[model samples]
Target: MSTNHEELTRLARTLNPQIIDEFRANRGKMKNFPGPEFLLLHTHGARSNQPRTTPLRYIKEGDTYILIAANGGAPRNPDWYYNILAHPNDVTIEVETEQLNVRATVAPPAERDRLFAEVVRQAPDFAKAQKGTSRTMPIVLLECVTEKD
Candidate 1:
């Protein structure tokens, strides 16, 4: 609550439409980003169960995509957090030009620390976000679907 998340969320709300449009239009090559790279997280609402999508920054771990709940030190967890909690296996992501079905899981604490360290290694501003927040940002693992699944 003591970080830039409020302002960042405000900006994201104002610009998400344009960013989403450009992301789709350009096949995931965003044009006017002021921060990190983004991916589209598709999920259903926690309460309404309605479909939803949000733009997010992510890191890759082998084939899995790691989504940390850091909205540049967002004031609160995004709605997608609740959505994934309600529907963990029912998730998808739009990465660049490809649409992927994925299952979501929140990493346990130790794993979160490790994964977060890796994220900060790749995108260091996440460290700044960490410094600003009292809460531990959740690390969401979007495991890819397989034919067996």
Candidate 2:
């Protein structure tokens, strides 16, 4: 992780658990948190195979949830991005009170452009975060899946 990424992760580590607890306590709604809607992303470590949960801001589009690997605009993508890539099929996400079995996919170019714009429009802090980095932010979609699918 880059310095900025490390700092951001440290902050997340310190704060996300509390936020997640509060969100669950409130039955999926968040109070007094910065940014837009958030979800609890449950994934395994890419290499360690250990379970990890991350609280990330998300956008809902139909049945899929969209996330940005913004890492607060760090030079590199966040660790969860690689974890999701490594175990795309085994991911679970909690939206408010519901847990969705999901698969991760990078949005296509046109959709990436439009969805990213929609996210930034809804949460401008993401735009501010992207301004500090040169790499294009990755838009990740958590597409819902059934046992048969």
lDDT tens per residue, model 1, 1-149 = 54466677688889888878989998887777645568999999999999988988888889989999875665577788989999998898999998898989999999999999999988888899878777778999998896213
* Model 1: per-residue Cα lDDT at residue 115: 96
What's the lDDT for residue 80 in model 1? 88
Note the Cα lDDT for every prediction shown.
Answer: 0.85, 0.89
> Against the hidden reference, what TM-scores do the models get?
0.87, 0.92
- 60: Cα error in model 1, Å: 0.5
lDDT of 1 at 122: 82
Clash tally, candidates in order: 1, 0
- Candidate 1 is scored at a TM of 0.87
Give the worst 10-residue stretch by lDDT in candidate 1. Answer: 1-10
